[model samples]
Target: MRLASLSLRYKILDFLYKVYPEAVEELTIIHVFYEYHTVDDIKKHLNYLVDKGYIEQKEICLRLGTKKTTNIYKITSKGIDLMQGIIQDKAIPIPEDE
Candidate 1:
């Protein structure tokens, strides 16, 4: 379970890194992993990233028709550093291909 959680976190960071500077909607992130993980599981990993200062989360309100609030996540400088090997977290193992 612990390994799985770490892998999920790493993948989340990787995805966010690939799209750096662009925030991803919560639903979109969840949808990407819906086949193997529950919404709650994906949320938990997102929260973990936020708490670690590796990612930033913000709530955006859309007024298209009605007021709708949603979360958007983006990787932070620290997260980029981790991806670049300037910093490291044992839990999130760096991928070799990177």
Candidate 2:
């Protein structure tokens, strides 16, 4: 089932949090949400998190015959704080399970 945008963003954050210091490629994130969301949907949420400083984004460029770019995402301290309820945002509706 498709989740609301807010819920999707929350899920993205939670998933990233589970990996902590390890950064995940955009493709991996797409796989996680593919059943419920589109690539564009996942990218939009990822960009939003980067803009809000909740996550850090890195782009790696690879060259073989053509240039290819991959986006890697990792949760920031602010993101961890948000997950821990140390900070709150009206945009992300985090659950109170922690």
Q: Using TM-score as the measure, which candidate wins?
A: 1
lDDT of 1 by residue, 1-98 (tens): 57887889998999999998899999999999888888898999999999999999999886666788899999999999998999989988887788
Cα displacement (angstroms), candidate 2, residue 34, comes to 1.3
Residue 4 local lDDT, model 2: 91
Report how far residue 57 has shifted in candidate 1, in Å: 0.4
Per-residue C-alpha lDDT of model 2 across residues 3-47, encoded as one tens digit per residue:
498999899999999999899999999999989888898999999
lDDT of 1 at 37: 80
Q: Model 2 Cα displacement at 4 (Å)? A: 1.1
In model 2, which runs have C-alpha deviations exceeding 4 angstroms? 1-3, 62-66
- lDDT for model 2 comes to 0.91
- What CA RMSD would candidate 2 show? 2.6
Give one clash count per candidate, in the order shown. Answer: 0, 0
Cα-based RMSD of candidate 1 = 1.5
Error of 1 at 21 (Å): 1.3
